[model samples]
Target: MLNRFKSVVSNVMGGLPAIPHQTEIPEDPNSLQVKFHYNRPDFLFLTSDEVELTADHISRPILVPRCVNKLPWKAGYAEVINAGKSKSNEDQATAMHFHIMAHMTETLLNKTDNQVEMTDMANTGGEFDNSLEYTYFAIFDGHAGTGAALMASNTLHKHIQERLLEVKDLLLCSNEDKMNDILKKRNMSANVNLPTKRITKDSLVKGALETAFCDMDEQIARERTTFRIKGGCTALVALFFGAKLYVANAGDCRAVIYRGEEIIPMSTDFTPVSERKRIAYLGYLQPELLHNEFTHLEFQKRVHRRDIGKKILCRDALMDGWFYKTVEEQDLKYPLIYGEGKRTRVLATIGVTRGFGDHDLKVHSSDIHIKPFLSPVPEVQVYDMTSCEHTEDDILVMGSDGLWDVMTNQDTGRIVREDLRKFSQNEDSRYTSAAQELVSKARGHLHPKGRGWRMENDRPSSGDDITAFIIPLSQLNSPSCSINTQNGHIPEKLENG
Candidate 1:
C-alpha cells in the first residue's frame, strides 16, 4: 500500500525522486565543552569558552540514544518529587516544574523531515547598555518544508528587536496628552499602550515583541520567494528580563515553568476549530457535524461531486484540486470522500482549523455562508516579568515536542527534583549535569524493546528530533537582557545582579 502511494507521488512530481527522510543525531560532535553555573542574584549562566577554544571539532548527527533495558508503557502516568534544602548556606530553596506536549504530523512519512535554527548568546558586553543583562531562547516548528521554519527561527528575534528600537521615539513620549493624540491617530489603543514616560530598560520589551511577529509575517511575503512552505511553524520564545521571566508564544511549541515540583504551562495551544464554541461561532451546525454518519457521507459526496465539477456551490471555487488528486490516488477515505457509492458530501479537507500562511484558503467574513471554514487569526500570549513567582532554587525547562513524546510532565519533574536533591545533599553528586543527561536519557528511553521498535504497529518508529535547555534557578543571578540587532543575531547577557 505504501509503495502504491509512493508511486502516485512520484508520478505527480513528473517522475522526480521523492525526498529522503532525515533524522537528528545526538548533540553536535563539534559542539564546545560547556558547563552550567550560577553567577549572582540577577543571573544564571551556561558557557562554552573551552568548547569554543577546542579546534577541529567535528559535527555529529543528532540521533536518539538506545536504551540498555526495557520498560512498560503506563498510560497518562506522571511523577513529581521535591528536593530538600541544600547543605550550602548561600543557595536559596527553589521549586521545579515541567509538562509534556505532542502533536502528530499531517504527513504519514515516518521520519521527522524538518529543519531547525537555534542560536544561544550569553555573557556579552555590548554598546546598548552594559548595566542590563539578558538571555534569549526560541523554538520554531515547521511543516511542509523546513525553509520558512529556518528563516523564522533565525531572523524573527532580531527583526522584532530592531522594530522596537526604531519606534523608541514614539514609545518614549512623556506627555499623556501628546501620547494619546499620537496613539489615537495611529489607531493604537490607550488601554494597552506602551509605557512611554518611564522608558526604563524594560520599557521596549513589549513593543519589540509585538512588532517582531507582526513585521516578520509581512516581511516574508515581500521577499517573493517560492521557498516559503505551504504550512507554518509554531514559535515559543523565553526572554529573561532583569530578574523576571517574559514568555511570548504563537502556535504550540510551549514554554513551561517549574516551581518546586509543580508544572505550570506558560503558553496556550491556539486550536480554534478544536473549541466547540469557536466552531459554533462560525455557524457550523453542531449536531449535524457531531460524529453523525449521514452528515459525514453527505459532506463527502458533495465534495467528490464538486471535484469533478458536477456541483457548483458558493464555496466550490475555493477548493484546491491538488488535495483531490492526492487523496484519490492514495485511495484514502478522506472526510470528503466516504461511503461506498452514490452518497457523499464534502465537509472539510484538513483537520486543523487555524494556522498561518494559508491565506489563499481563507473565506471572507462578509461571504456569510462559507465564513465558517476560514482560518482564525493567530493568537498571541504574553507572560509578564512580574507575574512569575521566582525563587533562588527554581529551574526552567524549555524544549520541543520530541522530549514530550516518550515522557510525561510528571516524569520530567520527578527526575529533575530527585537529581537536584542528590546534588544538594551530597557534595560529590554531579547534579549540575542534569540538563545534558536528560536529553541522553530521553533518547535512550525511546526504544527499550530495541532500536527503532514501534510498540503499536510492530514497525520501526522513526526517532523524533529533540532540542532543549535546562537552567537551575540558583544559577540565575544575572540581569536578563536580549537585543535583536538588525544583523539577524540576537545577543543576550546573563549578568551577575
Candidate 2:
C-alpha cells in the first residue's frame, strides 16, 4: 500500500520514487493469507481476461457495463485505469437491490416462554408493509492497494442490510399511533421498550447507515490480521429507502444531484485539507500518537531552525485564524497536517482523513499509527424523494475523486444535460452515454512525445483511476417503484429515458 503512495509522490517529484521512509510490508512465508483477486463489478459482465485488459495503462480504455439492464433504475456506469499510477485500478463500485423480509421483524418481536420462537405469525409467508425493498449504490476509492476497496464493495451492503433488519420494526412505525398499536399487539415486553426521547423514522434510517459504515470498517480491521487485505479506501454510499435518499460518505468520492438548472451536493469530501481541525484536535488530545515528531499546530510557512525563539503566524487545534506564537523546540516538529488543497497530507503521508482499514498504517518509518487520526464514521445527508417532483432529466451523478479532480459540479451537470438531450426520450443507453462522456472529459486525450494527457482546456488530465455512476431520479418518482401500503408489492416497471 505504501509502495503505491510512494509512486504517486515520486511522480509528483518528476522523477524516481523519492519517498524513502515509506516501505512495503514483507510477506511472512509461514503465515497463511487469504487474498481476494482484483476484478471489475460483476454487473459489467467482463471476463477475467477482459478485467485484466482494462488495467492496461498504455491503452487506458474507458469501460462501461455491457447492458443497461445490469443495473437497477437502468443506472449507467463507467471506469478507466490510471496513467500507470498503480498496476491495477484501485477504484471499485457496487449496485444492488435488497429486500428486507417480513419474517426478520417477527423474529425479533415474537417470543414464547422467555425464548424467541418462530411462531405462526413469523412464518405466515405473507407480504406486509413491514417488509421493504431498497436500492444501494456505492463507490470505494482505494489507495496503496485495492484490498480494502474490494472487501468494501463485496460486503458493505450486507452490513447495511443487517443493520436495517435490526431496526425493521421501528422503521415500520411511522407515527405514535402505529408504534403504540404494534407495541401493544406484541404483548408488553419489558425488554423491548421505546426510548425516553422521541425518535423520528429518519433518525433510525440514518443511524442504520452510520453504524453500517462503522461495522464494515471494524470487519476490515479484525480480518486483516488473518487475511491479505491491504491499504485503505474511502467509502461513498447512497441508499434509496422508502421515499427518502440517504447519502453517507467517508472519503473523497462525491455525489451530486442534477435537478433542473441547479446542482445539489449530497456528499462532502473528507480530506486533510477540509478536515484539518478534527485531525488536529485528535493530535492535541493524544500527543503520543504524534511520537513527538509532529505538532498539532500549523504555521503559515515552515519554521526554520533559525526561526526558533521567534514569533511566527500559527493556528492551533482550536484556532481558525493565525496568531503569532514564539516557535519553541517542540514547535520545530512537522505539523500534523501539511500542504494545501490536493497536496495536503497528514504526517506527510495519506491525503484523505476518513475511511476504512488503514489499521496498520504508520507514518513512514515511525511507529506512529495513522488510524487513530483517521475516522470510519460517515457524514450522512438525507433528501426526501417524495418532496420534489423529479423528471426523467433529473439524475444523481456519483464519481470518485478522479472525475471531480478535473470537472466541477456545474461542469458535470452541464455535460450530462447536453448528453441526455442528444438521445430521444425512449433511449435507455443515454445514461450510459452520459457516464461515458463524463469519464472521457475527465480523462482527456493522451499527447505524443511523452507530453502526457491534456484536458480540452490544455490542463493536465487526471492520471488517477476514474469511476462514475449516473442514476435516474425519475425511477424514484415513478409510481411503480414506490411502496404499496395496501398490497406490499411494488410493480417492477422501472424504465429509462
Measured by lDDT, the strongest candidate is: 2
> What is candidate 1's lDDT per residue for 1-497, written digit by digit as tens?
23333343333234332322222212452342211121111112113441121111121122111110000110011111101111111111111111001111212112111111111212122223322234455655543334335545545655544544455445445544565567565654535555443333344566566567756656544542333333344566666544556666655445566787678776655433233245433333443332332121112232342255333232112232322222222122222222221111112222233323332222111111222342323344444445555554466666554455555677667766665555553232233345444544454423464454232334432134444545544444533222111222211321110
lDDT of 1: 0.37
lDDT of each residue in 409-452, candidate 2, tens digit only: 99999999999999986687889899988898898888876789
Runs in model 2 with CA error above 4 Å? Answer: 1-31, 105-128, 180-195, 477-497
Please give the lDDT score at residue 435 for candidate 2. 96
Q: Rate the local accuracy (lDDT) of all candidates.
A: 0.37, 0.79
RMSD of each: 16.3, 7.2
Off by over 4 Å in 1: 1-134, 166-208, 224-231, 242-244, 271-392, 422-432, 445-462, 472-497
Among all windows of ten consecutive residues in candidate 2, which has the lowest summed lDDT? 109-118
What shift in Å separates residue 276 of candidate 1 from its native position after superposition? 6.0
Error of 2 at 147 (Å): 0.5
